[model samples]
Target: MKTKIFGHRGSAGTHPENTMISFKEAARVGADGIELDIQMTKDGVIVVIHDETVKRTTNGKDKGWVKDYTLKQLKKMDASYKFKDQYGICEIPTLEEVFDWAKSNQLLINVEFKTGLVAYKGIEEKTLKMINDYGLEDRIVLSSFNHYSLVKCRQLSSTIDLAILYMEGLYEPWDYAKRLHTNGIHPYHQTINKEIVDESIRNGIAVRPFTINDEKKMKEFIDYGCSAIITDHPKMAAALIK
Candidate 1:
């Protein structure tokens, strides 16, 4: 099968990571999927963002922890602070807003739960319910660094796809994934090679490496027949694949 390309944080190299404009740019560039991180707000609303703190990506006056702000408070901050001169202000988008936008397109959504740092109680259930409500289970892939959270997600829903996110090399990670009831693995780009990809595929596990921005590495992994690659430059990957 031809390898797929997923936009990392929605073309993060060009647009502000995790913002709606970034996601739209990914789709416009013909990306097959878009990967994003989600963190819960103080009121239990799921919002798209990478950092646990707003200081890194936003122009909020407080620049506090994400969990400490309500959705309304969070929206007032400019998520595109880095690109403010170019894109003006961009509000942090809610998962629901993204879902509503995604419904109009065919892009697959890989939602990474940011629970490894702060365990947002009921985040799994809330996200799952929203996916189901939007009838997007088939297009959504839930992944996390927290294996326990992945297990909880498995207990909640057996059909939706789950992938383990790891930065280190693990022995026979496919087997480990099987034990966790997950079907896919998202490893750091440097942690995998041809042998591991072959082994994982042999065991019915899909391997998709992350944050591969270099042209050489992108071509190498695609040639290796990886299930997918997450990259900050989807346009470049798409051109190479074609």
Candidate 2:
């Protein structure tokens, strides 16, 4: 089980998360794939920002970013504007834009579904449609902690691979993925160990851990037979691992 470099939120260590610029840098570093989170906006538009309340990720003018506003409103807020003095003002991009860039650049993408309490209103359907629309069944990996979202995706897209993202101390999760017909398991960085990873591998399930930036930690993931390792610094990890 050789580990490949999966960029977390598109080289977020270098730039803001879920942006075209960040993803481009990640591709420049030769990441095997880039990971991003998705949340739908008020007008039922599926955008690529992570938080349910967009206050943290975007520089919004009013109450919340995505909860009350549509993609048009989201476009006005500069997600990286606050960091302009530091990293410069970069605006938030939609999922369509992200996928377009990734597909054109021949990059693999891991899109995480985050629906907040409201469940992003048909994001799974939209995502499945996008996968088909972009003809990215082979290049994109759809993942989510929400089993319902993943299940919907599996039902919707026959070819687009699905990964069930879980955190530490999860009990008997493989049974769930099997039921959902998922292709892989994506776990948090700290919780994965040699035993679980090997078990997953033995079952013919692909195992990938998320957001691992530590070189030694990544070495351990490789030692555990993880299929892939998602990282904030794919450039650094790719350099060190080679």
Candidate 3:
């Protein structure tokens, strides 16, 4: 079977990362799903963004004030973040805003709990509630490098498809999944090879790679039967998949 394609931060290659504009663009280009990162704000609101700091994605003067600011304050900050001169005015999007966008579409959503100066506790429950509010229990997947978050989601909703995200070789993911009872593993794209890929397939564990943009490298993983790829360049991936 062909692998499913998810837009990393909503095809971040086209628009600024984590904005609804980017998600809209990804869906416009036929992405099967969107990969989103979640973080809790200072006011206990769940917002969609990638980095621990807002400075990277927003034109914030300070680096660590993302959560210190309210959701409205976050929206007021310009999200036209430029690293290499590519400009896009993307505002911060709330979890509800994203779910509203996904409600009537065929777009599957993967919400990654990204914690770094903030505790990810209760984020899983909040995310699950948001998904349920939209009646998208079957159309969304929740993943996290924090095994506890994924486990908590399972505790809250067993029927929810869970995926473990790992950056390093901390443990045998297949064994971890078996112990944790997760259905999928979403690992950093560069960490995979033929051996591990084959092993995942043999073990009946779904493997999806992250942030892959190189065409040649993408084909190699697809040839190895990858379950999916969370990518920055969905158009490139679409062409490669074709």
Candidate 4:
């Protein structure tokens, strides 16, 4: 199988990370999929963002925890704060908005639950319902650093895909993944090697390393026969794959 390229936070190297524009750019560049993070708002609405605190991504005016703001309040801040001079203001996108938009394209969506820190009550159930409502189970992959959250998601839906996200080296992670009922692993790019990739693939587990932006490293992973690579520059990776 051809190694797939998934846009990390939607072509984060070029566009404002996690915004709709970033996602659209990734699709336009022929990325096989897009990876994004999700956190619940103060009003319990699921939104696409990477940080627990809004101070880093959003305009400084709204500086606080994401859980402190309602969806409406979050929409008011500019998520494109870092690139304001270039892209202007971009609102934080809701999961519903992303799902609705995703229907227009044939892009696989990797939704990473931001539950490693603040465990949003009932987030797994709520997110699963939204995915079902959008009828996107086949195209979606749910991943997280929290193994407990992954287990919860598996319990809620037997058919949906689950991937474990980890940063450290593991002794035969495929075995651990099997025990957790997860079929995929998204490891920190630096933590994966040829043996790990080969073993995981042999065991029918997908191996996709995250945030790989270096050209040489991208080529190395592709050569290792990884199922996919999550990268910040989808355009560059697509060019390489071609």
Candidate 5:
């Protein structure tokens, strides 16, 4: 099969990361999928954003933590102000909004739980329930650097595809994934090599590397036969694959 291109934070190279504008642009530019981060707001709402702090993506001056604000408060912040003006005003979208948008499309959604930094209680249950409610169980893949959270997710649903994300080398990531009963492994792009990709393929586990932006590097991973690549430049990657 051809390698798949998943927009990392939804065409983040040219748009506000994790905002609806970026997601739409990724689809418009022919990305096979989109990778986004999720965290729970103070009101227990699942919000789509990458960082624990809203300062980086939003126009908030004090650098508010997502956990410290309610969904209403978060929605009020302008998430696209830092980006080029063409992106227009963007708000932090609730996970439900994303699901509603995704239901009509064929794009794969890689939802990374932002639990490695802040472990929101009941986030796993909430996420699983929401995914099921949206009827996106098959089209969504849950990933996190927190392996325990992934195990908790499996405890709730056996069929939800899960992937373990790590930034460092692993002895045998496929084996670890097997133990976790996950279907895939997400390694940092720089950590992947031909041997790792081959082993993952042989083991029937998907190998997806993250944040790949360079054209040459994207082609290298494709040549290594990666199952998918999460990149800030999904349009560029899609063009290269063609």
Candidate 6:
């Protein structure tokens, strides 16, 4: 089977990470899926951003926690100004906006919940409901480093696809996936190997390794038959695969 290429943070290497412009660039480059991060604002609106704080990606410094800012406050900051002016004042998009784009474009989205550090109390339910409202249950994959969050997501919606994200090597990852009732495992690129990829495939679990920017590593994972490779340079990976 051909390996899928998922744009990491919506082609983060070329565009401002997690912005709508970045996601549009990923789609333009022909990526199979787009990976993004979701976190709740103080008003409980889900916003697409990778970091808990907006300091690094936005014009503002020391903006405190993402959850502390209301959507109106968060939207005031320019998400793409730090990267380049060509991106043209990209705003941190709401999950609903992204869901609308994804549904219209028929693109697969891997929504990584930024719950590893702060457990946003009803994020799972809110996220799931949004996905359902958009009729995108088949196209969305909910993934997170916090396994407990994935479990909660599963408890809320059994049909939603869940992937466990971990940075360490796992033993019999497929068994662990079975226990969690997840459909996939997302490992840090450095932790994935041929054996684990093969085992995951054998057990019918998707193995997608993340943040691979190097062409050599991308080729290696493709050779290992990963279900997908999540990378900052989706165009490079797509060219190499072709």
Model 6 lowest lDDT segment of ten: 81-90
- In model 2, what is the error at residue 149, expressed in angstroms? 0.5
Model 4: which residue pairs collide? none
lDDT of 4 by residue, 22-80 (tens): 99999999999999999999999999999999999988474899988999888888999
RMSD of each: 0.7, 1.7, 2.0, 0.8, 1.0, 1.1
Q: On a 0 to 100 scale, what is the lDDT of residue 193 in model 5?
A: 89
Q: Could you tally the backbone clashes for each prediction?
A: 0, 0, 0, 0, 0, 0
**lDDT string, candidate 1, 1-242, tens digits:** 99999999998988988999999999999899999999999999999999999999998787799999999999889999578888888889999999999989999999999998999999999999999999999999999999998999999999989999999989899999999999899999899899999999999999999989999999999989999999999999999999
lDDT of 4 at 203: 98
Off by over 4 Å in 2: 63-65
For 1-242, candidate 2 gives per-residue lDDT tens digits of 35788889888887888787778888899788899988887887778887777778777866474657877888887877334667777877888888777667777889998853665677788888887898888888889888788888877767678899877666655665677899888988777678877777777678888879888887788777688899989998788667
Q: Between 2 and 3, whose lDDT is larger?
A: 3
Tell me how candidate 4 scores on lDDT.
0.94
The list of candidate 5 runs beyond 4 A from truth reads none
* Candidate with the larger lDDT of 1 and 3: 1
> 39-63 in candidate 5: lDDT tens per residue?
9999999999989999778887689
Q: Output the worst ten-in-a-row residue range by lDDT, candidate 3.
A: 80-89
TM-score of 2: 0.93
Tally clashes: model 6: 0
Off by over 4 Å in 4: none
Q: Output the lDDT of residue 218, model 3.
A: 78
User: What residue pairs clash in candidate 3, if any at all?
Assistant: none
